[model samples]
Each structure stands twice: as C-alpha cells, then as structure tokens.
Target: MSGSLRSREREMGVVILDGSTVRAFVGDEEVFNRSVDERFAALDLNGDGVLSRAELRRALETFRLLETHFGVDVVTPPAEVAALYNSIFDQFDLDRSGTVDRDEFRSEMRRILLAIADGLGDFPLQIVLEDDDQGSNLLQQAVDLEAAKTKAAASGK
Candidate 1:
C-alpha cells in the first residue's frame, strides 16, 4: 500500500499485462458490461441502485490505481486524500446527481480502463491481481476469457 505500486495479495501469480489485454477485455461488450455491473452492485452496499461517495470509495480501493485504500501513499496528507476522493466522485457523477447511476458508473469505468490501456500501450509488465472471481477484478477475467476462446477454437479445429 506504500512505496512501490506492487502490493501483496495471497493466492495470486504474476500475470503479464499490456494494452492489448486490457483493450481485449473492454472490447468485449458483454463481458465488460456484466463485469462492471457485478462490481457496481458489490460497491452498492445498500443496493440503492446508485453509488454513494462511500460506495465509490470502495470501488476505487478495488482499483488501487487512482488511490490506495488509503491515499496514494503514506506520506499523503489527509486533506489531499479527501480532495482526491472528492474529485474522483465528481468525475463519476457526470450529471452531478450527488450519486452515480449505472450508466455513469459504466461510462467512467470505460474511460478509466481505456486510459490504462493507452498507458500500457503494448508494454508488457508483470503484475499481481486478486483471485476474487466475483467479478471484482475484470482484467484477469479478460485474460481468462480470451484464453478460453482460443482453447475452444483450437479444439473445434
């Protein structure tokens, strides 16, 4: 959670990731939508059908990209962390409803994922992802999904 981006998670292995892997996942509309919905629901702890700031914070923690469960690093002051979370919530609350509906959630998620893909841009790097198969982490699912498709095609041939 501090210093390096690498954080430890039990029961995970290093996976090579690049822009193509991320793009492949986002490109699959069905998988992407379903996965987003699942994660969104998980964040919607109250099942209110919209994400509250607290809920959105949970989602960001899952992301651990924009900010850690804590702020970016241990050195970051509390005020900056609060502002950071506020900015993120504002970004997602496109209509400024003070809450994020599914559409807004999906739209913002797509933008973030695409930006990550652009940053990676074919540069493969080994990273660890949680094995939480509950759709919390979709990138790994994407990799698995693409592998399954490849396997199916090979067997069919």
Candidate 2:
C-alpha cells in the first residue's frame, strides 16, 4: 500500500485501503499515542462513551481546516472526504444499528488519525443504535449538528 508521506522523511506514516485494512506506523509509539489521544478528545464532543456521526463530521471539518492552514496537499476533494468518513462510520457501526460503542469508536478514530498524521486523507469517524428510539436520538443529533454548522458558517462565525 502506498502512503501520502514519504516514509523516509517522517517518523510515522499510514497506508489506507478501501476496505478494512488501515495500516499505521508504530515506529514512533509516543507520537502515535499522543496523536490518537488528541484526536479522540476532539471527536468526543459530549464526553459521552460513544461518538455520533455529527461529532465525527465536526472532526472532519477541523481536519479540513488544518489541512488548509498547513498548506498540505489534499488528494481527495471535500465531497469525497465526507463520503469516505460516512462509509467508515457505517463499517464501524458493526451492529447495523445506529451507535458505535466506545471501543469501536476509538479503534476507527485511531485508524483515521493515523491516516491523517501521514497526510493521507481527511479522516476521523463513528456509531449506530439498534432500537428505533435510540436510532432517532442519534439521527436528531446529526441533524442538529449539521444545522448548527450551516448557521455558523452563514453568519461568518
């Protein structure tokens, strides 16, 4: 698998594939740990045990901002980036339900952060709930979050 960053130039790198395999360089454990921690905190906005799709989408927004601020070359466009994370979210939601548990959320988020650390893609993702009630809860949160982002952007904030 090819990576966005030259392996020789960076202490850590990632090789992401279309399927389940997302490889991260464990060559620098300390850096990798720190990156994962920081990324996780940013995505778990409610400090809840699990992450919603809304939270993951917000994380992607930050990723896009950072990439632009740092002048990093993005191989994927914004729409594709959104679709990628959406696809990941579906996969991470193992139960076909609506919410991802803490363990699953962390694992997928780590994979995404690893890819981003290597400048591969705008990655960060999450969960599903099985019950109709719980699924509605998650869906509401997603709608609300998306609305807030739109409003904020429209107001130039």
Off by over 4 Å in 2: 1-34, 65-85, 109-157
Top TM-score: which candidate number? 1
- 1-157, model 1: which lDDT tens digit per residue? 4554445554675778888888898998998999999888888999999999998887676655544453344456779778988999999999988999999999998998899889988888888776774747777876777778889999995
**Worst ten in a row by lDDT for model 1:** 65-74
Per-model TM values vs. the true structure = 0.82, 0.37
Candidate 1 lDDT for residue 27: 90
Collision pairs in model 1:
none
TM-score of 2: 0.37
Strongest candidate by lDDT:
1
